[model samples]
Target: MNTGAVLLYHAAQLYCNLYKVTDFQAKETAGIGVYSALSLINHSCYPSVKHYFIGRSLVMRAVRPISAGEELTISYIKPFQKAKKQERKILLQRYWFSCTCEACVNDWPTFPNLPALRFKCLGCKNPLDGRPRVCYACVTKRRDPDKPQTEQMEVVDSIWRGILNACCTDLALNIGQKKTREDYLTVCQNLQLLYEHVAMPCQHVIIMHQLLYKYFEDEF
Candidate 1:
């Protein structure tokens, strides 16, 4: 019998729990025991069942309904990453068979790299070789490119929120009244500018403005 058929038989014998099948019958399958019963379910590049683990237990659920006579299948790994050559080696060594899946047919890369959405500074764009510093050219630019500007604004907004939260909780004031007032005023002014220009005038900015107004009103 093929590796997939053998796995199915083993899964059936273990009452359909791949985890238990692998754990109890590991010596029978060689240390190549299945990580999930779903693993024994055979493989298709496009599979119906999505398998994951709930702690040590292998959990399998239908990604879509299965029809009769269709070989029940699960993914050996993410289809996008499993090149034909690599998959064949794994299946031959571990499952004792060869794989013939659509993913393999297409000659997809064994490890697909995900695309990044952020722009890097022109001077320090290397992914592996730099401790990034603000580039002089970037500083000279009138406006930052979208990605860096978005990141900077996010940091500033987070700091402003932290300051507001501290004021609301009375933590800032408890340290020293003068210091608290100065910090609060600085945060409020910076927040106002960030809200107007950087935060896109979102409702959160309006709410924060209302909160700051109430805080100062009550204090004064």
Candidate 2:
């Protein structure tokens, strides 16, 4: 019946930018927020940056190196928690948009779907997944004389072991041993290294972003 209310309703449908306000310390949902600037950010299944609330204000931080001219993004959904096909469906059904992120386009398996360890290419270190032998990039690189051979994949065994034993690796959160901030930092660092070798949306990378955010929060 109210003219202004009708307009606001339509605008909310088209422009409403909602984000889960989380209290990391409490590990619970604080509420939700809608900021005009943050609203402008587009959704990516694999976001380049992450944002958090600081006393009702928002702080955005980059989790990985960003090249010049690259667009900043954040994930509205937990891409690591769900499978690719289901994640795509959720994004389409809820946001009315399909994700074309590297993970989605390449059909990278989510963290839930990955095994304790994954196989990587002997050349590029890119995840082989189910691909036969080496990936196409490595195959092409073989022809180039300038490109050097990647290290043996077996070298990352320690790194993988670190992740498997990480406090955040399992649901229990390391009940046996107390995890100090330094401990978390070590795990996050190893995760970043693991990320460099695996495919995009790899468990190590996504989980690293999540943990690194919490680590920095504790640091500063």
Candidate 3:
């Protein structure tokens, strides 16, 4: 019997279906395992669901509101909310599939040191590149009404950029440590103040949402 070959094949199957079992409370890798149901869910960089370990039982919970019939998804990798599309693709290569998640396809800006943030057009509320005074759609609204308009309602990109820059600088002081519960609460509240102004699919918002979920799930 070719025992070595059998073990290799078994390892490959596990690689494709494995889930990193994270200690929700400790926020670290406890181990890995295979789950039949979870392996069926697709991968999205900006996943709709986040999973964690609870004493060998894997629990999947939605990070955002999903519409009826929307396909369920969970990220195959971690800390990718800030990564570029190409970088993310490289990280996900082990899964043997190219990621086309909303964040990846649109190249969503990451925080702490975000690039020039983009906001919506004041006239038509469509996303305008580089803060243009008026977007092409709004300018040619009457002439070409069929132009696509973004549903994301972003404004004050510069303000958020500055806020994150300050945040990252402060956070660097406490690197490799979780923020105090009070710190998370304060951050969440401050984010709420400008929550409405932020565009859909924002990386900072997504990352914070995941953190809050993890915190409350384990601590509370």
Top candidate when judged by TM-score against the true structure: 2
Among residues 3 or more apart in sequence or in different chains, the pairs in candidate 2 whose N, CA or C atoms overlap within 3 Å are: none
Q: Clashes in each model (backbone N, CA, C under 3 Å)?
A: 1, 0, 0
Query: Where is model 1 poorest over a 10-residue stretch in terms of lDDT?
Result: 21-30
Query: Model 3, range 1-220, lDDT digits (tens) per residue?
Result: 4999999988888978977787776778878888999988999877888787787888886656577999999988754456767778788899888888777777765555443334445456555564343467767333332232233322244435544654663465347544455654544554453344444555556555754564444432
Error of 3 at 175 (Å): 20
lDDT of 1 by residue, 115-146 (tens): 21223344443221122344444443324445
The TM-score obtained by model 1 is 0.30
Report residue 2 deviation for candidate 3 (angstroms): 15
Off by over 4 Å in 1: 1-40, 55-57, 64-69, 77-84, 110-220
RMSD of 1: 18.3
Q: What are the per-model C-alpha RMSD values against the true structure?
A: 18.3, 5.5, 7.5
For each candidate, what is the lDDT? 0.47, 0.64, 0.63
* Candidate 2 segments exceeding 4 Å error: 1-10, 13-15, 115-189, 216-219
Q: What is the TM-score (0 to 1) of candidate 2?
A: 0.65
